[model samples]
Target: MAGTTLGAASPALAQKKPEAAKPAPPKLSKPVMAVVMAVQKLQQAGDHAGALAKLTEAAAVPRAEKDDALILAKLKLFSAQTIKDNAKLEEGLTEAVEAPSITPDEKLMFSKFVAGLASNRKDYGKAWTWYEFYLGQKPDDVEITVQAASVAAALKQPARVYELLTKAIDLREAKNETGDRSWYEFRAQTAIDNKMDDKLLPSLLGWVKAFPEPKSYNLAIGLVKQRQGNLDNNVLVDFGRLMSAAGAMTDANNYLEYADAALDRGMPNEAEIVLKEGIAKQLLDGSKQNIKEFVAQAASKNAESKAGLAALEKDAKTSPRLALVVADTFANLKQYDKAITWYKTLVGNAMIDQDTVNLRLAFALKNSGDAAGAKAALANVKAGPRAIIAKFMDVVIGDAA
Candidate 1:
């Protein structure tokens, strides 16, 4: 009888134990879950406007509270991007700002978006305010500092730029445990722009000591020395050391300017020596072989040298000022045809002022024994002071013709 009863209970008891007191599945609010699902579907379909509209409606729906802050912030960003309406965008942003659950990353993203929108509308003040807010939250942000400095520069607030850059430099130095050499360069340039030469001198000196090989620093120092009427052997020696360390290349316009300064100061002997030394070092080092091409090109156009102007001309195509220099060099060498060719190129490309090109073409034609071409070129000259001058010169040339 016991065996019979146990067997009878066993099958039912096993089944009942498996089903007894099972925890109910967590109940998701159907309406809220549906709204979230709708938002996700709309976003996935690239219908951001629809997504935001759904989110806005869901935000107003009572009792749909879980993940609300996240959903609202997302809706705000999507709405801001979709509407192109600043008022609505700001409204969304205000909501986001109020959402205490917003993460720092989300805040940064929203702030940048607002700042870009404000900037596009030329609302610089608003842009600055937004950027400032973002920076306050992330104080050591170098990219923001650089951007703020640039914006301040564009706004013509040099003092503000200076302050921002100074702070950025200090922050960078503190973070790296070392001083920033570029900051000194920026300060020197700012001082130059402001005509605060006395301030510039110290900054320049500091940059030179810090970044001696940056050629520009040396050039700045040389300029400062020249401005102070100190173009003596001592200054030359310092420049020479910088040139050697930088493997001074003659092709650089800065080097040419330095040479010209030396020559202008009655130091042609020194200028020649420096050029020779630079050329020798450049040839031996092979670091600045391009300078050789530059020098050869200049010499080829020299009436006394005629070295390799063609190669230089080819390279000059990449540099407008160099093209002009080549043309002038040809003119000075009495290669009037080559000069006229370049001058015509300049005119055809509209690279030079129309009036200037016409006058130069007139002169080139006259010198090339094409008095008629000269007269015709002058005819293209527009009526201005330059045109009047060209007409008068034409009459004189015509009389001679």
Candidate 2:
């Protein structure tokens, strides 16, 4: 007993509009009109059972014209609605909408109305069908589209939910409208639940770009990292950098992964930086044996690695990978000028991907407080995952870039 009712005044008893604006009502026979009036009076008097009985009698009247049938159907709908008889109301509504006298506008309204009734009854499949019908007629109805997506979700149709909500969200954004936060959340969550990895990044990127909340940033970066499955250490380092820049290093695992990836890539200085920052942020328990081991390992080679950087820079010209490794270490150590120089040195080298070089240069430039330089470098990144990450970084740097 939710105590909910469709409490609006019945359409049958709606006050007539100005003659110029109103469509002509279906002409009812003498018998059907008399029954219709009686049912309305009974409903107004709160005699729902009598109102329904009168409509049932009206249904039996011999109908010579389509208007007679249409009037009878509307009377049944009004009576059924008065008594809150959902089954009869659904039947009456379907009959009324199919009548020859029903306008396209009326049919669309009925589609939405019946869809709501089905949702209230938790008949999601029926609700989805009705909602689809309404949306087919009026695809621009964002609110209804979201409702339909919700119904599709309840029916365990994740792909359909993704399709409907993505269209709605993109449509709103195209109009320069900010969508409701929940819409983005639903779209992202649906992608995650379905393990739609291909869809996850774009879904999250759209969400974080629009909302730019810390929690969403964490999810956007972290979820993709979690699902990427055995990335190259260099790629993992890039992921770690993005997560760190976004302030999305929410757990010890994030710190550990970043540090381990740096260590594996022969960048002890970078590992040391990540481990130290994690400890300072209280996100890593330094007293833990594994963390203690990492801290000591990161420190063991860190100084020696820095000492060898001059020699490394000499060999960097022949090895773009070596240069990138050194650049990443410099960036991690907050030596952004050296990092940017090395990243730029590798640009258009043909031996290494120019997009990678540019994207890395952008990261270093942005860290160095040169947003314009960062954006220029980012603009050169137009291939693979780095391009996508570059797009996200552009949003992070904001319009100032």
Q: Which candidate wins on TM-score?
A: 2
Question: Tens digits of per-residue lDDT for model 1 on 1-401?
Answer: 00011111222210112446884433345676687678778877878778777877777665445445555554555544554545556556656655565556666756754555555556667667777787788778766776666666667787777677667766765675434556666767777798775466555554554454546544654556456554454234324423433433434444555455544433334344445565665533325575455444443333232455677688778866566656644654557899888877777555556665666667667768888988888888785444544544454455558
CA lDDT, candidate 2, residue 54:
77
lDDT of 2: 0.79
Alpha carbon RMSD to native, model 1:
25.1
lDDT tens digits by residue: candidate 2, 165-207: 8988988999998788998898999999898878888898889
lDDT of each: 0.57, 0.79
Off by over 4 Å in 1: 1-41, 44-46, 52-73, 78-95, 98-109, 120-122, 174-187, 202-211, 229-401
- Candidate 2 off by > 4 Å: 1-18, 21-26, 76-88, 122-129, 154-159, 192-198, 315-322, 353-355, 379-388, 398-401
